[model samples]
Target chain A: MRKIKDLGEFGLLRELGLFGQKLPEGWIGPGDDCAIAPKSGGNLAITTDLLIEDIHFRLSTTGPRDLGWKAAAVNLSDLASMGARPLALTVGAALPKNLPFEWAEEFYKGLRECADRFDCVLAGGDTSSAEKICLSVTALGDMEGRSPLLRSGARENDDLWLSGEPGESAAGLLLLEKGLSGGKALEKCLRRHLCPEPRVELGLLLAERRLANSAIDVSDGVLADAGHISERSGLKVLVEAGKIPMSRELCACAAKSGADPFELALGGGEDYELLFTAPPKNREAILEIGKGLGLGVALVGKVEKGSGVSLLGEDGREMEPKRSGWSHF
Target chain B: MRKIKDLGEFGLLRELGLFGQKLPEGWIGPGDDCAIAPKSGGNLAITTDLLIEDIHFRLSTTGPRDLGWKAAAVNLSDLASMGARPLALTVGAALPKNLPFEWAEEFYKGLRECADRFDCVLAGGDTSSAEKICLSVTALGDMEGRSPLLRSGARENDDLWLSGEPGESAAGLLLLEKGLSGGKALEKCLRRHLCPEPRVELGLLLAERRLANSAIDVSDGVLADAGHISERSGLKVLVEAGKIPMSRELCACAAKSGADPFELALGGGEDYELLFTAPPKNREAILEIGKGLGLGVALVGKVEKGSGVSLLGEDGREMEPKRSGWSHF
Candidate 1:
């Protein structure tokens, strides 16, 4: 009879996972970015994200459209990591009665924009009134005959590749928190924070071509996501902090604001970038695919015969990393 | 630009459904119990329900196990009405930091029980801390090649039927609110409110055998659900007050307490009973099936020409029913 506060989010998940096994046929239980299930002999990937006010966002700063985009984006990121073809999405919103109808309309517009951008359909969901805004988006996708990339498939010598910018979203959050408005520099960071683009095309290419051995989306920072791959694959992940991808805008803003760029890239969360592992044989092809898709691909780290994650600085020295992710407890 | 409060829940849905209709292959949008989608040429029924504290239930009255049960049951009922085989479920929860650990464990236990009872798998979900306890459950089901019974399929002159005891759950809620405990008379009612059994078997039987023309579970009372059928099918539905089957226990309790049993049957929500329409030729077969399943079956109404729902008193006079259900504004 332990309390939830004592157990923390991860502890509770571990406890819940004890019962998550014993999945039915056509279904694989929890432990991945999304749950993969066979529907009528075809595989479908499903993922869900819970966005809460104050914990994940504040109404004062978050607009209606951005709130909706981030909600769908977070779940879509999980879908992207699985290399699943987007199909349908369902949104359950618990909002206050005083919330404007126009706000909901704008929210749907954003949600629909993200869905339509990836050619996904917005399906059905339930709505209710609550004290604070709470949104839960469930995104469903088709595997398109290709096996989904999982967090557990990395080999001992796999090269870890990252797609898209890391830490820019967090840097944007820092800027907003400091009440710094204006400048083209700040707008890019703000967009990263407010609306993220899930790397669906890159994930599909990785899975379809069998390039990536393992995959995950950067939601709770790169270090945390890499750690998930390490824990699940039973391998050590060593990330070269200097090699972590950061947009030029993010670098300039970080330097100007007196924040360490490497630290921000290592520990800033909610970038929605794809962090995946591929064997050396696929390196050239992976780069070609990334370029073809117009996404930046960086070989930031490698998997080894060990456990947990370690970050190495440009000087080949390890620095104490900031704890990644927000603990709900 | 209408405000959400001004538009009400139905209007917002109408707006959302504007986009919902543009679904991908093998998928039908909103305006029904669940969204029907094709996966590998077979249809999957997807439905979601949002349960919020104080709005859907109270922490003071509901134990965590019951909370989980209701959350799963409500969504399962939607799946049941769609005549889908329960496959997997996803739950997204928003909770307070100080919530008890025992409560969460108990909640999972209850969720597992319901899933196991129906041979459904417990998939993964996302959890976060919020201002109040809120749960969103998405239920997925396999329809097994049979055309699902939609709410809009009722033919004119169809015989409407009901399974199980109506108003029992609401009666139970009344008992709990009035602080009435420890009586056999109240035990049945309380159990109905606290733990509702989704009529999966009956719903499956109706769909598999192609007996039911239209189906919906009684969640927002029988009248409101009937309205859904009428609105979708564009046919007049007449429900006789006397035919709405109530248990003998309910009759005795209602008479003793001077409560209107008929009103309770029509307006009391969360009954989780299957209310469906079948042709006259299928009535005998339906009763046989109900008898085999050990469930009560009664012909309670009829669908005919015209529109909207009309309730008849025992004397054959029409009565204006009280509009029940939460209007999310």
Candidate 2:
């Protein structure tokens, strides 16, 4: 396990910068008082997210670096969902009295690393005292000339697609909770859960190429997130259960824990994968985008002229999961 | 007190829009993914702040509308300190479990009100669950083709000035904490404490006219925030006790509480006024701008070729306040 203090503040941020590599159009990519990005004709994209201690993470299970990374990632994910490129981030942190300065520095390092990776800079933020640590990150992005891809844009007959493997984060969470480890494979899953990557590059590719009709990030499980698309688009979506992708490590863990891999794949959260839809004509173009970016592209379902989301079981029956995944409130 | 629930989600935002009438140059003012602003021809000005329950405020005392207002104001205050004009804002809210939907609506109403007042738009944000309510707001601003006014810009022999009354918010807080209720005067002070308005217009005027050599908002307190200027600029500032302006209401409350008005004015936080310095030549211009804005401006101090901040006591002796103000550790 990596301790946040091991990297210090600046060191951790340096690591985060490594992951955020692509720049969206019109953004002067971070490292300033504010990020300037060209918007829909000159409009900019801005979003914020807040994560609380105990409510958002437990220190015993999560490290400071991961917490900081998650804070920025969640906000950036919102920008991605809107088809915006991240430019700058500002953070507000409330630390408990007992928190060490070194810990705070490490936390900032993680945040800086993540911001730099996306070519975004840590502009400025507020710090204060609290009984528990709390973090809030606001991400700014450029919209360029593209219309933001909203959750409401999926029309009837559009094809729904996902950017990468689903349910891996949830599987990692399950493994962490049970104290079960499977060496390198389990390590990868657990890392995915703790430090789920935001699909900013893939989102930008879709927006740049005008391939996605609508897009969303799978933060709260495939079923629930897809439900958002269904509700907003006023359309029905049929997802084939077997077609949902799962890592082999996740499958093995599910089998060992007596959990259904398919169920986890559908109902797990924190995947941070891009879930989008487009016309059938865009299929080949999107696939080519995936190949260019070295990301997996999966066509999972289709949009129909009705409301609600359904699942197709192996027996050719429509099925609903026992739960609808996680909800903030 | 206005409850956040009184306004529906979108209604509250609409109410907020009423306040955002004026916009600075090169700003894609409000209502997008992010606010876009040009700083120094190419740079941008960004800042973020977070407020949480039992940390920044208590619901029993502070109204939800005020919370929303303060969240945006604090971030805007940071931009003002940098001599930047408000552009756009993003928010991240974490609501408690079993939270009423109306609470969020009312909060957004307050947020919208503040943003609109500052000509800022609520761009985009994320909402999630928490054990307590948390708000994180990030404000983007334009530097108007000039370098941002950093804390390091003050030079020796510069004249120090303050816009509006100081320490009213802190005085207001003392009254609230002591549960000391007076008449309308106390009520006014309490309101000031609850909702400290950021001096955005004045800041812009100063920057536009190039009247200030350096600037920062009176957030942490006069002495502490001035200390940032001193540390960064490597110059000492001698603040005149008599020159520090106080609202009549604040003075009256302080007298009743047997508190030193000067001490409160120096060490109390959340004033949200602009504290700036300029060469002696700019004095007339500064005064003219203040008059044009109908704002009360005062010459409070002078920057000297030394390090540290000092107060000129009535006895002609240098005095330091017992407390330097709030420190977020």
Which model scores highest in TM-score?
1
Candidate with top lDDT is 1
Off by over 4 Å in 2: A1-42, A314-323, B1-42, B98-106, B144-146, B314-323
- The Cα error of candidate 1 at residue B315, in Å, is 3.4
lDDT of each: 0.85, 0.72
* Per-residue lDDT of model 2, residues A110-199, tens digit only: 776687678665555656566666677777777766667778789889998987888778888888778787677678778888877787
Task: Note the DockQ of each predicted structure.
Answer: 0.66, 0.21
Among all windows of ten consecutive residues in candidate 1 chain A, which has the lowest summed lDDT? A17-26
lDDT of 1 by residue, A251-299 (tens): 8778767898777888889989999999988999999998898889999
TM-score of chain B of 2: 0.86
Give model 2's DockQ, 2 decimals. Answer: 0.21
